[model samples]
Target: MRRLPLLLLPLALAACNGGTGTPVTIDVKSDDGDNGSFRMENGTVSIKGDGFQGNFRVPQIKMKADDVDLDGVKLYPKSEIAGFHITGGDKPGNGKDGGKDGSKGGGKDDGKVRIDFTSPASLAAVQNWFRDGFTKKGFTFASRGDGFAGTTSDGGTFTLDLSADGGQKVKGRMEMTGS
Candidate 1:
């Protein structure tokens, strides 16, 4: 009986260490069906674990876009982020970084549309919106800093910024050219 407990100890430890964690992947695409690609190079994200924590380093990422080439885009830790949250569809506040605010109304003035989601499903939905939204609006965009910038086919420049909080929440920014 004493030996039985000892033998079970290692088995229990192995079970806890099983490598079955799911990895998160983000894909970016353009709306116009134009041929272009976006890539993320040299990035790191810190994830909080229960009692224990971990970090991941992404050396590179390859994103396929319809019209613009984003092969050189990259993301790195600007500062330590904690307690991240993800929201979707016309949120009021800006992302965790307090970068830019999102707008509610949908129109030519809406310019940029922001969507927030955590799982792949939500991200896919948002990407689809990006495709349709820009296409319907007739706009061309390019990656700018930690966000994007471009001119609408109607001759309006817009800026959009998206931030993810440790796979918890995503916030968006939709700012028109002037004001």
Candidate 2:
């Protein structure tokens, strides 16, 4: 696995009205695979998967999204197991000055964040949700043969594979590979 270089990726999220915005429940199921379920409520998020289970309360988050704030919303996973959170760690660097954090080695270094999830929202609504959300933060997107591809203002790239689950649920896979 490679580490994505840190760049000025252009992606965005919008801020809701109140300080305590509407909390979202993410169903961890996808069109191609099913991871499990993630219920984010009150201040804690509970995870249930095929071979793993864990629960942790989120810190008090008064996060308000800015047009250019990539970390406006944050997810802090408390599970000891690896791969629970998105965006694995970067590989340690070899430097004379020891610029890299050596303690971060031996962890997942895949330069990708893959999330599969479903919601009761319609496919169109879900599509528009991402489309509008990212474009506002300055990501240029185009429809691809596989799905929708987008590049951030700083050239970071991501792909979205989405499908309707035949019910009202919209299923999607979000793979983010960025520098």
Which one wins on TM-score?
Answer: 2
- RMSD (Å) per prediction: 19.4, 12.4
Error of 1 at 159 (Å): 0.7
Candidate 1: list runs displaced more than 4 Å. 1-124, 145-147, 166-168
TM, every model: 0.28, 0.43
- lDDT by residue (1-179, candidate 1, tens digit) is 11322332232233232232222222212222211111112343343312323344443222112212112221121211111122112122322332234444233222232222222223334344455566566568866654567776656566656555444344444444411
Q: How many clashing pairs per prediction, in order?
A: 8, 2
Query: lDDT of candidate 2?
Result: 0.45
Model 2 residue 34 lDDT? 32
After the best TM-score superposition of candidate 2, give how far the Cα of residue 74 lies from its true spot, in angstroms: 11
Off by over 4 Å in 2: 1-110
